[model samples]
Structures are given as structure tokens and as C-alpha cells.
Target: MLYPNGWFAVCLSSSLKPGRLRTVAFMGNELLVYRTRSGRVRVIEPHCPHLGAHFGYGGKVDGENLVCPFHGLVFGPNGVCIGAGRSRTPPRAKLDEWLVQERAGAVLVWRHNKGKAPDWEVPDSNMAGFSAAQEACFELKGYSYYGPENTADATHFMQVHHLTDVAMSHEIRQHQMEVNLTASWFGWQIKVRMINYGVGCAYAESELPAWGLFMKSYSFGTPIAPLKWTYTLLDSTHVRWLDALPRVLRWPPQALVGALMHWLTVKEIRKDFRIWNHRRHVNDPKLMQGEMHIAAFRRWMMQFYLRD
Candidate 1:
């Protein structure tokens, strides 16, 4: 699913001070992202053509350009040549620049074929809201699609965790059914049933937008995808979920069922996380068999994934 003209990458967080360079990869290419002395962000290929040295490891920010440690070659934000150690260098040889921007408190670099960027904004403001909250991360050893699939799969709530309060069924025949999902500024909001279903039964949704922060990619290239999600619970406290769901469950204790249910739900989610460490993949072609949201997810993915 990695496409040169159809992929985007999160380069780094906005907290990084100026003159700092970090290396990140997306769609099979390495990106060198750095903050200028004045706090501006720039994205470029990590390699210096002069000697093929990776600037990520030892690159320094020089004024508004990045200076290569090996040859004092400087490249501007647009990947244009600004300076070189050699007195007179050919202007035709310039560093390659990727479309980069700061949104939602993170640096994002575009990698597609210079195509127009996706419609979603970088979400700079939303990111700042969570700056003070604690942060954590985890790895799922499964295909990247598994993460998205888990979010949209509602039936698993009961079978996997043994908790049944939410029932979700897509009206498959109605392709034009209007689906309205509104989130507050902090990425948490209660679903108001203005269009379909009934009140009080709607679900609460919270997570980073899938295209921006929600996109997951493993750094180790082990196919172990990583997904980041957050939630604000009833106590006005925030919780960030970085683990995966489990594969099996122990169903019993029907009398103390309430307590048992809570215990098993937590345990099951942890188990799913552990199981994810062994599985990989997101979209299942077999979703046509019984899953309904899978279709909507597929269509949603195509809309942004293939957006021009």
C-alpha cells in the first residue's frame, strides 16, 4: 500500500527546537527533517549527493538551510542550493525537497509524485491540547491494516471482550445513508444521534484523525504496525491506548458477572495487544463475508488514500 505519489509521513514533533534534524521514513524513502534557527521546518532527502552521506546522523541546521557535516553543503527548505564549500558549484545539482508542513504540533512531509496534498489539515492546534498529557507507545506484530480494522469492527467488543452494550449494524443497502461524526477540539466527543439511531445509545468516539497522526508504520520493518489512540474517560482524566487486543478469552463467572466482565475486558484487550505482536495485515478481502463497516472503511481509505 506504499505509493510514492500516494503516501504521507509524520516527520517529527513540533517540540523539537531549531537546528535539530531527525530522520524518518515513509513510503519506502528516508526523510531528513530539520528545524531552522528560527523554528521553521524543512524536509529533504537524507543523502548528500556530493558524497552520499546521510545528513540525518550528523546534519546541522545553518540559518535557514541544512548543512551537511561532511562537505559543508547547505540546502534550503525547498531543497534549493544555497551554499557549498566549493567556490563555484553547478546550480543544476540541488537537494531534493519534499512537501512539508507543520500541523497539529507535528512536522509532516508529503512524498507523493508532487501531487496535491490531502484535504485534512495538519491539526496543529489539536496536538497542542495534549502536550501536557502522558505519552506511551506499543507495537503490534501484524499487517498494518489490522489496527484500522479493529477500530471499525464493533462485533468484536462482545466476542473478544465479553462486554455487550453497543450494537452496531450498517445499513448496507442504503449507500447514501448520511453518516455524521463530529469531534470536539480535543478529539473527544459524544456521538449525537441527529440523523440515525436513537439518543443515549450512540457511541463515544475518540482518536487521532487516521490520515495524520493515526497512520501507523513500523520503524523496524518487521511488519509490526503501531497505532496510537487516546480517550478522555468519565473522571476528566485522559487515557492513551497504545496496546493491541488479544485473540482468546476465558468466559465464565456468570454470577459475579459484572466484576468478571470488567476484569476480562481489560485482560482481553491486553491479550489482543499481545496477539497483535504476532499478526499483521489490516484489510481482509474476506470482509465481504459478514463485516459491514469494513466496506465503509475500504471506501473511506480509497477516498483519502487515492485523493488527488
Candidate 2:
């Protein structure tokens, strides 16, 4: 199948500074991500149209445009060549520009196999009073779809996480999927809500309201090569005492609580890695009654796969 179409988080917004260019590899393509002098981010095809010089290497930012190192040609944010070395800009000198947006502390780009515009937008984490407190980045030897779709696997909670009394409810809407899970974890009642936007990005919030503890996390999966994917996990926590108490009194407890949650979240991902690494894709399988959502998820994912 062709690459799924949607918004993909390429890198953290803080990683790219003004007048800096970086190369990112995703979906079997190399992209040049740069921030202009005016603090605007742009994602474009890496090669310059003038002489096919790669813009990711030795590229200079001239105000709000990118200067190719080969002949000092300048290309504007719209990917149109604006100037050349003492020469008029050619009518056909242009590079392809991808749609980019900065949201939720990350740089996101819209990707479509057929070169179509984005049909939906990713939700901003700040709007929900959430911030990334911990982040983990690593490569996984599996397809990109496995990570986000795992949320809908209801039976995996008891088998993988050792949670009891697991109950899951799923709500599917246009361009989004929400899964709510209520379970018992090591004697604590846990409620987890996961929202997936497209196939590559998802956000989850887990709360233990009785203890005044809450955690919000975002997960992104991007394909770098054939059967090789990169997964980024960002976790944030909100504790009532941390906000209500004085800074001096809150420092110790806040750090300890946040560290504990981060550790457990990392451990869970490690367990998932073991399974996803060796699992094979089965087009047709005899599934039990409880596995109905898995089928529905596959059907929903078909919309993103555009065939030529």
C-alpha cells in the first residue's frame, strides 16, 4: 500500500531555530525544514530547481527565503525562485512546498499521495492546558500503523499491561477515533482516554482522579524506510498539589511523581516493541467476537491509502 495521507509531526518546534535548515527523512522522502528570519517555518523538497543542488546542506537563509549554495539562487517560502546571481529568475525555477504548521510544540506537515490539501487539522495540546513534560524517541522495527491502532485493541490491556476489569468503549467519527478505557491497575482505578487523528498521530490522557493525578501524552509514528519506523512519545502530568502548594514545598513531590509516571510509560512502550517487532501482517484471519474493532479500524484506514 502507498503511504497514508494526513498530518505528520516531523520534529519538535524548539529544535528548529530562526535561519536554520535541517533535513528530515519520512515516508521514504527527504524534506528540507527551515525557519526563516521572521520565525516562519517552511518544509520543501530538498533539491533546488536551478541545478538540482540539495538545499539541506550549506543552505543560507536570506530574510524569509532560502538561498541555494550552488549558485546563490533565492527561493521564497512559496517555492518560487525570486532571484539569481545577477540574473533574472527563471519562469520555471520552482521547488515543491509542503503544507506546514506549528502546533502542540511540534512541527507538523501535511502529506497526501495524490497532492491534495489537508482535510482535517491536528488539535493543539495547549488548548487543553497540557504541556510535554517527558519525551522518548526511538526506532521501532514495524509498520507505522501498529502504534496508533494498538489503542483500539481491548484485549491487550489484561494480556500486556496486567490490568484487570478492563472495559473499553470506542467512538468513531469523521477523521478521528476516540477510545475510552476503565480498568484497575495495581489497586488504583485508572481511566484512560485516547484520541487518534488519522493513522500517524494520537493523544492520550490517563487520570487517577481519586489521587489528584493526571497525565497527558502524545504519540507520533512516521515511516522512515521500508519496515522501519520512528516513534515519539511525549508525556505530561498535572497534579493538583503541584499547583496549589508553594514552590518550595512542591518541588520534591512534583519531581518524584513525574519521574515515576514517566518510567512506567516507557516500560509499557518497551513491552509493545517486543510484540510489534516480530508480528506479521495478516490480511485474512479468524478473529474472535471481541476483536471486532480491529476489523473496523482496518476498514477506516483504507480511506487514507490512495491508489494510482
Candidate 3:
């Protein structure tokens, strides 16, 4: 069973077609999804409870409700039985309502025994920052724990892709600050100034949380157990390199920075993608104890995975 106690991405927002149903597996169960005539989204048991017929392949939306193709049974978005087969006997009040929400241009469904929604809000990223944002899906030939662990494994940032001057090298010694607790914040800012091994030095803050490795990230897995990831690059170096470099370059201002930054970032990302593709579900010395980001990110992950 997938998403045993959390939300999982099922499909991109563009996959849902009006009046057409799609069967998806979540929380170890099959859910039938379809858009109503009024464009409302609905989820229900994939098989018709009356006779075990697949609902997704032949289902239709009637007004704001979803109707079974086999028996013409109708269900509301709340999973209430609004009507069945033209019978006015008042539908049963015992239907189950599934939890579904949209985040990062994708539609997610939560399957749980408690049937509750998450209180945390997904960050609203400035989608226009990237020079290009393309959606493509790839398979992970391994287990989820490995994928989660990769987010904190920074040593590879340099070794695997030959990326130098990453965030890991900006170590702050004798800079002791206690971890702060917060109830919640729809937005946040992080500030840090340090002498680093990168091109000169800079100060930056981002809305995305620093989780071991990935800040702004997205991933999903099916109940059948394969996982996939679609990474979006924000502000590529080719797009902002020269401005990012601490000192003015010796060449044309825009020409040097934009072209150089984008080229380097794209080259590094392609290398990382190749490394990521070959790593299925292997456990390695990806991280060690006392690593700065792992513990914090694990806690954050738990908050999302275990929240009622």
C-alpha cells in the first residue's frame, strides 16, 4: 500500500480530462478519478461496489456528479451517493470521500485510515524564474529510502558530477546557533554570510527549506512501488552566472555571465541526471552521522508523512 500515512503525487494537473475517468492506486487501494460536467474533480472506488465492474474505463460525469457506466449509479465529489439508476429513494449516506489536493502543478491524493487532510501548505514557487520548466517523468530502479537519502548526500555534489564550490564547502566554524522551533509559516527566509570556495562570495536567502540535499523538490511513487522524479531548475547559471560572480568579468557584461552560468549549470545537471538514472535502490555511505542537513530534513519529512 502506497501513501500509508501521507500524500502522494498521482498525476500532473494536465492529465485529468473532463468527463473521462482514470483509475489510480493510492494507499494500497484503487481509486477512480474523473472530472464532472461542471469541471469538479471526484474520486471513488475504482470498481463498482454493486458488481465489481471497473468504473474508470466507462464512467461518465452527469452534471456535478460521477455516474457508473455499468449501472448508472451516481456519486458526488464528497463521495455521497446522490442517486442511483433513476431511483429517488435517496442515496445511501455511507460513501467514502477521498482526500485530493493540487501542488507544484501536480494533483496529489491522500489515502489514509483516518481520512484527514494535511495542514501544511506547499510552497508557492515563482514558476517564471526558470528559463525553461519542462515536465518529464523518469523511473527509479530502486527503493524510496534511497531516494530520500540522496537529498542529504552532499559529498556527491562534487564527486559524481564534478560540481565544485557547492554549498557543502561553505563550512562555518565556531558559528553555533541553536535550532529554532516554529508553529508554522506560509513563507520563510534564511540568511547566511560566509567565506566560501566558490567564485568570490555572496549572500542569498530562499523560500525553499534546506533538506539535506534538495531544497525545492518534488517526487512521487505508485502503490505498485516504482518511483519517479521531475526536477525543475530555477535560475540556471547560463541565465544568471556573470551577475552571480562576485567580480566583474573581463568580457561583455551580459554575454559572459549569462552564457557561462547557463552552460556550467546545464552541464553539471546532465551529469547528475546520468548518475541518478543508474542508481536504483542501493544503500551506500551516502551520508554520515552529524551531517548538518539530514536530521533536520528527516524531521520535516516526518511532519508531512505522519500528520493527521
Candidate 4:
């Protein structure tokens, strides 16, 4: 199984400024991701269509076009070679384009075997009400589909995340999964609700009613190559009482909680990296009755891959 056919995040939206270009590794190949002068992100094949120079090396963004390093050929947002050096007129060449979109402050590219068009769209959340995302990225030694399966495994949370008195339930809808849970952590009763979108992305919200604190987190896992992937997490917190406080005092507490949430979340997820980095997936797993959801999740994931 190579990288499965689905949407995988390529990079952070904030990383690509206007007229910035980057060489990104995605789905076992190299892609050129660039933002135009007007701030539109485009993902394309990394080579100059005419001479075959990799754009990641010396590629430059000219206004709304991407300039080739070799012959200064220009490619527009549609990946068409619209400008060639000198007065020879643009050649009948075009760079290949990939389906990409920005959501929750990250760029997601839809990938499929044999270049098939995407069948579904990723759902959006209400991020406008939250603060700016506190982010972290990790280069993991393991592959993905592993990240999403964790939602169904409860025993590991107790051993890995150190949970106490946890109850969880799930609602599945084809490519999407909603998980709601109530847990007791260090005497605080917390409620968490998460939406897992395909194998690549997850959006989660944590609520502390007594403290009037709400936290949101977006997680993405992107495959860089075989048996390796990149994991990114962005977290933000909103304190309900902040709005009642003075303007000067409103944001500080919220920002402080956001920062702390980011730190603690990152710390907890790092514990799983130790296991995920070294674990292997077995086609036929030995499962207990309590782990039935893990098996169901694996069955659900098969739809994301191309079939024979």
C-alpha cells in the first residue's frame, strides 16, 4: 500500500507568503508549492516543462506566475507555460497541477492513484471564533492511517495518555467519524469532541465547563515517503469569561491558555510517537472484544485505497 488515495496536508498556510515558493515532498514525490503575488497557493509538478530543471532549486515567483530557473519560462496558476524566454512565444507546454485547498490554516492536496479527480470535499469548521492557532510539526519515523486509528483504541489512552475514568462513543458517516468523550483527568471533568476527516486530518474541541475554557485542535498527517510521514498539530483556546473582562485583560488569559494547551497537547502526543514510530501493521490482527472499534476503523479505511 503506497500513500492512500485521499487528501493529505502539504504545508501550513502561514508558511507560504505572497510570492514565496517551496519544494515539498508529498505522496512519495516532490511537488512545487508556491503562493502568487495575490496570495493564492498552487501545487504543481516540480520541473520546468521545457528543459526539466527542478523548480525547488531556483524557482522564483514573478507576479502571479512561477518562473523557471533554467530558461526563465513562466507558468501561470493553471500550470500552463504561458511565458518563454525571448520573443519565441510560449511553447505548447504545461506543468501538471494537483488539487489543493486551504482550510483550518493548512494546505491540503487531494491525491489519487492514476490521477483521478476527488470524489468528496473536506468539511469546514467554525474557526473564526477561536484565537490564532498554536502550531507544532514533527517528522515521524512511522507511516499513516496509524494516526486516525487511535480514536478507537481506548486501552492505549489509559497507558499512553494517562487517563482516568473515561467513557467514549462514536458516530460514523462514511469518510467522516465523530467521537465524543467525557473523561476525568486530575480531578477535572473534561468533555472532548473530535471529527476525523479521512486518514489525513482531524479537528477536535475540548471543553471545561466549570472553568469556562474551550480548546480546539487541528491535526494532520502527511506521507513524505514509504513508512514515513509528517505530523502537524495546531491548537487554540478560548476563555468564555474573557469577553466580560477589560479589553486589556481579555486576550492575555486566552493567549496564555492557548499556549499552555499547545504545549501540553504536544507533550502528550509525543508519547505515542515512541510507539507509532516502531509499530508494524498486521493484516490479520489479534483483537479483544473491547478493541472491536479498532477493527471497524481498519475496515472503514479500506475505502480510501484504490481497489483491484
- Cα TM-score per model: 0.60, 0.92, 0.60, 0.96
- The positional error of residue 66 in candidate 4, measured at the CA in angstroms, is 1.0
Candidate 4 per-residue lDDT over residues 90-175, each given as its tens digit: 88898888889998888999987777787777766776646778988888977788888887777777788888887888888988
Candidate 4 worst ten-residue window by lDDT: 121-130
lDDT of 3 by residue, 221-253 (tens): 333344533332323112333335544452254
Backbone clash count, each prediction separately: 19, 0, 7, 0
Compare candidates 2 and 3 on TM-score and give the better one: 2
Q: Write the per-residue lDDT of candidate 2 for residues 148-176, one digit (tens) a residue.
A: 77898888888998999988888889889
- Among the numbered candidates, top TM-score falls to 4
Candidate 1 regions with alpha-carbon error over 4 angstroms: 1-15, 86-91, 113-117, 122-131, 169-271, 280-284, 287-290, 303-308
Give the poorly placed runs of model 4, Cα more than 4 Å off: none
Which of candidates 1 and 2 is the stronger one according to TM-score? Answer: 2
Residue pairs clashing, model 2? none
Residue 296 C-alpha lDDT in model 3: 40
Using lDDT, rank the candidates from best to worst. Answer: 4, 2, 3, 1
lDDT over C-alpha atoms for residue 133 of model 1:
21
Per-residue C-alpha lDDT of model 1 across residues 1-308, encoded as one tens digit per residue: 43323223343353467888777544444667778887777777789877888998777887787777777787776676677777657244578777666532345454344467544332222322111322122333434434434545655544664444444444322211123233332333223111111100012223333311121111111111233221111101112231121212211221133243334334545656665656644555666455677577566444333435
| RMSD after CA superposition, every candidate | 12.2, 2.1, 10.6, 1.4
Query: lDDT at 243 for candidate 3?
Result: 38
